[model samples]
Target: MQRNTLGNTGLEVGPLCIGTSTLAGFTETYGYDVDDERAVETVLAVFDSEVNYLDTGNNYGKDGLAERRVGEAIRRRGGLPEGFVLQTKVDADPVTGDYSGARVRRSLEESLERLGVDHLPVLALHDPEFMSADQDGFGPGGALEALVAIRDEGIADHLAVASGSVEVTQRYLDTGAFDVVLNHNRFTLLNREAQDLFEGARDKGLGVLNAAPYGGGMLVKGPAQQPKYCYGERDEAFAASALAMAEACEAAGVPLAAAALQFSTRSPLVDSTVVGISRPERIRETLALLAVEIPPALWVELESLRPDARI
Candidate 1:
């Protein structure tokens, strides 16, 4: 429940951030639907709990439905709790798929409208890899330009770079333009692709947010329930590697989910770990997992697996 300052952003947030993609009912993508009542309950539960930060995106639903759902919860509460921070993202146009400077501000405006807030303490560029830097996102009249302008205009307190690829994330971080950097499905136990990126961001004093510690739900559900990696179908090797880790966890008397959630938090370079939650009970479960202590021997055996090196 203790809060950590998210790098130079001057905002103190809980180590666990509530991710809202599941609340948007992106069933096709997230594998489940959370109705509005359930979404509001989950948001309020996390906010009322020790967790104090919530993350959503502009394109998280059919038409920014995720932001709207979070906004509804905020409105119902009359405002966010003291010290609570709300974060969202901007990127290519949902309709036109154009990643332009105009789209950047327009997206923020749309997100603000959906979230029912005037300003955001945190806003990130959703995915720069999808936007050719030279042509759209990092150029003169691109998304970054507009994001900086908005930050200077006091519309957003801080800007962040959120991407799935290390190369793309580093490309944005190299510019020294973001206050925070978020890499998803890369720094998990099964993948160390973002290890260097996390180090680089910490060196530059930028906040680092590691998301999807479960590796697209593999560490949480195993290959039997979900045989996917980074949202795509995984091969036999990937499944076998996950099975090995699960067996080791079982032997060590630790839950795979507990190890997965703590893996990111244990890193001194990681400022926050964002986790997606659907039901209110899931929030309680995650908090309990965060409290569970994994034995050193378990870590030793899990390290021997080296799924990142193999798969």
Candidate 2:
């Protein structure tokens, strides 16, 4: 329920942002169900809970259906909160794996029409690796140019890049264009790359939004249930580490989800963490977890269980 400023953009976001990727079936790209109604309900509940930040993307569905659904939900609710912040990603080409300047412009225009918003609170480049691989295709002359133009024209309030790698984040930081960065699974018990990112973001005055705080459900469900879109496979050592952390949480009377959400926020560099909610009950569960603080001794134990190296 705490709020933090998003870098220098003058935007205050909740500690837990609502992630809409699952709502659009991105999780199902491997094997998950598409729950449009439940997704809308979740968003509504998030707003009701005073969590005003929503993160989505244009390529979430066949033709920006996810953005449309979010837009409709806000409209049906009469409108979003007075100072609510809506953030969405731009993918160059949904059908083909192509990212270019022209595609970026087209995507933003279409997203605006679908969302029924004149300007986006925050716009992020979907994937860091893809953008780095084709810098020209996504660089200033390309998508970045379009994004800056939009900001200048008052079509977007700020620009951001959502990535999964430290290297990719550093590249964007070097450009000095992004106002914030969205990172995934970097600061988890299994990885500590976030430490470096935190330092970098602080030095550059960029706000950090930590995604996949639960390691894409692995931390919540445990290793017995493998994550659908995980970057690596689960092994015995990884399973052991996860179990140790889970047991520590149990012993300390703290839910793993609570630890996950609070861990990132404890870092001064991290502004917020995004948690996906499929059901209203899930929101209550997460909120309850958020209310409990992880003890210092418990944090030390949790850190001891971290993997020595990345997978």
**Model 1, backbone clash pairs (residues 3+ apart or across chains), number:** 0
Put down candidate 1 lDDT per residue, 177-244, tens digits, no spaces: 78999999888877788999999899888998999998768889888877887788665666778789
Which prediction has the highest lDDT against the true structure? 1
Error of 1 at 111 (Å): 0.5
Give the alpha carbon lDDT tens digit for every residue of 155-222 in model 2: 78788888787787777667777898888878876667777876788787888898877777777766
Poorest 10 consecutive residues of model 2 by lDDT?
226-235
lDDT of 1: 0.86
What C-alpha lDDT values do all the predictions have?
0.86, 0.76
Candidate 1 clashes between residue pairs 3 or more apart in a chain or in different chains: none
- TM-scores for the candidates: 0.96, 0.91
Report the Cα lDDT for residue 2, model 2.
Answer: 76
